[model samples]
Structures are given as C-alpha cells and as structure tokens.
Target: MTGARAMLPLGAALALGLWLWAVRDLPWPGWPLDPQAMTLDQIRMGYGMMPRGVVALLAGAALGLAGAILQVVLRNPVADPTTLGISAGAQLALVLATVAAPDLLGPGRWPIAMAGG
Candidate 1:
C-alpha cells in the first residue's frame, strides 16, 4: 500500500510531464502577456487546447474520485455510476430540465442532477 501510494505522485508527475512535452511545440503565449502580440496559433493553443486539456484532466480526476467513493460506500469493487444507474438518472434529470425549465439548467443543474441520481 505504501509503495502504491508512493507511485501515485510519480505516475501523476510522469503523465503531466508527458502532456507538457506533447504540447511543447504549440505556440504558447509569451510572458508580460500582451494579447496583441499573440499569433493565431498561440491564441488557439492558449485558449482552446490548453483549457480543453485542463478540463479533461480535472473531469477524469473527478470521475475517478466518484467511482472510488461509490465503490467504498457500496463495498463493491466493480461498482460504477453506469452500473448503478446514477449516470442514466443524472442524464434523465438534465434532459428533463432542459425540456421543462431551461433556465434551471444553468446554475442549479448540479443539484437537480444529484437529486435524480
């Protein structure tokens, strides 16, 4: 367990290093941050790709945490949101909210989805 815990940070660091290396060639925004100095590629990379990557990383982490919590709470190693219908319930709630009250779909969506799940 200790070895596994020790390896976690190392693995995360390796993954982050690889991600950085993969995007190293993309034109990045320069320091002293002048928006006018940024080229189109820099703008695309900084605004589009960087944010998308960060969001994906965070979403993956959140899903992993949720899965871990579900497994622990259910005492089932294979428990997942899909298997428990949690995802389906959340999706249904979101869809219903979208059709019923589109205005509630913005800031209050999380609570609505959690209620359904």
Candidate 2:
C-alpha cells in the first residue's frame, strides 16, 4: 500500500488509543435508563468527558480538512493559516473588537473571526 494509505489506520488507531488512555480514570456510564441512578463519576464521564472528546476529534478533523483544502487551492504542500495570515488576521480582529467594541464580542466571537479571516 501507498505510505499515506498505510498511515491512515495507524493514525486513527493511535488517536483512539490515546483517547482511551486519557479517559481510563473515568468510570464508564453504561446504559442507564434513569439519570438519577448514575453516580458522580459516571455522570462526569458521560456528560463532560464524552462531549469534549467528540468536539476535540471533530475540531481536529475539520482543521485537517481545512489544511488539505488550503494546500490544494494554493498549490503548495505547506500552505497553512499562518502562511496566509488568516489566524493572525482573526486574532487581530478579535483583539480590536475587544478593545474598540466589546459589545460585538458579547454576542458571538465566530462572526468576528470569520469577518477577519
């Protein structure tokens, strides 16, 4: 198999293994019919750790996709947010909004970031 194709499963396995290791301390919240029956550890695992893990995984996937798209569009293998100044622009915008118009940030930060990027 090609190197990239071969590495896909390896990367996924490594991520999964790492996630499992990170959450090893948390007790598994098995299929509980009643929420009241769940213990503190189970509730923390189910409500806190699980959603955060899912969000982290999704965000990582999205960043990878964005990087791939940027590289392809720019015709440069090393193209990234920094290369295009997107991240800097976004941060600058946020800082400016915070200093100039704090109200704008109170509503939502995503709009300002998108506008700047």
Candidate 3:
C-alpha cells in the first residue's frame, strides 16, 4: 500500500501525459507550452478540451458518490438523486430561477439552487 501510494503522483503524471499525447494532433499547430505562441484556435481548443476532461470527471464522480451515499442512507440498492426527486426539483428550480431572476446565476446563487433542490 505504501509503495502504491508513492507511485500515485507518477501515475497521475503518466495519465496526464497520455491525455495530452492523445490530443497532441487535434488539427492544431505547434504545442501549447507557450501560450503566447499559440494561435487563438489552438488556445480555444486547449481551454475547451481541459474543461471537457475536468468537468466530466468531476460531474461523474459527484453523481456516482451521491448515488452511492443515497443508496447507503436509504438502505436501497438504487436510490439515486432522480429517485429522490432531487434531480427534477433542482432542474425545475433552475429553470424558474432563470426565468424569474436571471441575476441569481451571477453570484451567491447556490442558496437559490438549494431552495430549488
């Protein structure tokens, strides 16, 4: 376990290297090491792809964790956010908030979201 813990950073580095390598030839020019030299399209692609990777990982993790917690707490094998009506309630609240008070999305918006939830 200690040996595996020591390799965790290296493993993360390897994963990052592989991810960058996979996108190295995304119809873009030169590397993005020096942002000043990167074209607007290349910069855009880099930023866009970073979020695609980060947000997806985060959202997936959150949902999976939430589902697991809900199942455990409810003592059921399949109690997800949707099953508890949280998913729908939040969406409905967000839609209503968007229509009634679009400003709620600007800052300190989470309380409103929780209300929706």
Candidate 4:
C-alpha cells in the first residue's frame, strides 16, 4: 500500500508528460478544418500555454471521488452520479444555457448545473 502510494505522483507525472508529448506535435485546427494546416504545436501555442491541465486533472479526480462517495452513501453497487439525477441536472442546465446565452456558458455552466442538482 505504501509503495503504491509513493507511485501515485510518479504515475500522474508520467501521464501528464505523455499527454503533453502526444498533443504537442499533432495537427490541431481552429474553428475551421482547412487545406493549409498547422501542427498541434501552433494551436497550443496560440492559446498562450495556459495551465489548464492541472485544473482538468483536479476536476476529473474530484468528480471521480464524488461519484465514489455518492455510491457508497447510497448503499447500492450501481448508484453512480447519474443515479442521483446529477447527470440530468447537468443536461438540463446545458440545454437552458444554450437557449439563454450560449456565449456565457463556459465556467458558469457547472455552477448553475450543480445548483440545479
């Protein structure tokens, strides 16, 4: 158990490193798929290399932990996050946001969705 605990950071670091390496050289496009193309390097660089990777990993871990907790609390093997209507609440918010103001649906969407849940 302790050995595995020590490997967690190394495992995460390796995963992140691999993801970055794979994406760094792939061809990524903006709004349009085009004949003249740029590699993934160009697309990532254009985004100014913002550190969203940590946030993404953290959010993923949080959701995973939440689902685990919810399943345990609900006392059912199949009680996933969706079983609690969380998924429906999220979908409803997305639909509402799309109808209300599609442009303002980035960060605000989750908060509104969770609130609805």
Residues 64-107 of candidate 1: C-alpha lDDT, one tens digit per residue = 99889999999999999899999999999989989998998678
- The lDDT, on a scale of 0 to 1, for candidate 3 is 0.81
Task: Highest lDDT: give the candidate number.
Answer: 2
Pick out the ten consecutive residues of candidate 2 with the lowest summed lDDT.
Answer: 26-35
Q: How many backbone clashes does candidate 1 have?
A: 0
Which scores higher on TM-score, 3 or 4?
Answer: 3
TM-score of 1: 0.67
RMSD in Å for all candidates: 3.5, 2.5, 6.7, 8.8
**Could you estimate the TM-score for every candidate?**
0.67, 0.81, 0.54, 0.45
In order, what lDDT does every prediction score? Answer: 0.86, 0.87, 0.81, 0.72
Checking candidate 2 for backbone clashes, the offending pairs are none
Clashes of each: 0, 0, 0, 1
Instruction: Please tell me which predicted candidate would have the highest TM-score against the true structure.
Output: 2
What TM value does model 2 have? 0.81
* lDDT-superior candidate, 3 or 4: 3
Tens-place lDDT digits, model 3, residues 1-117: 699789979988998899888877675655668889888778877778767888998997898787878888899887777788987888888889899989888876677768877
Looking at model 3, residue 29 earns an lDDT score of 55
Ranking by TM-score: 2, 1, 3, 4
Candidate 4 has its poorest 10 consecutive residues by lDDT at: 27-36
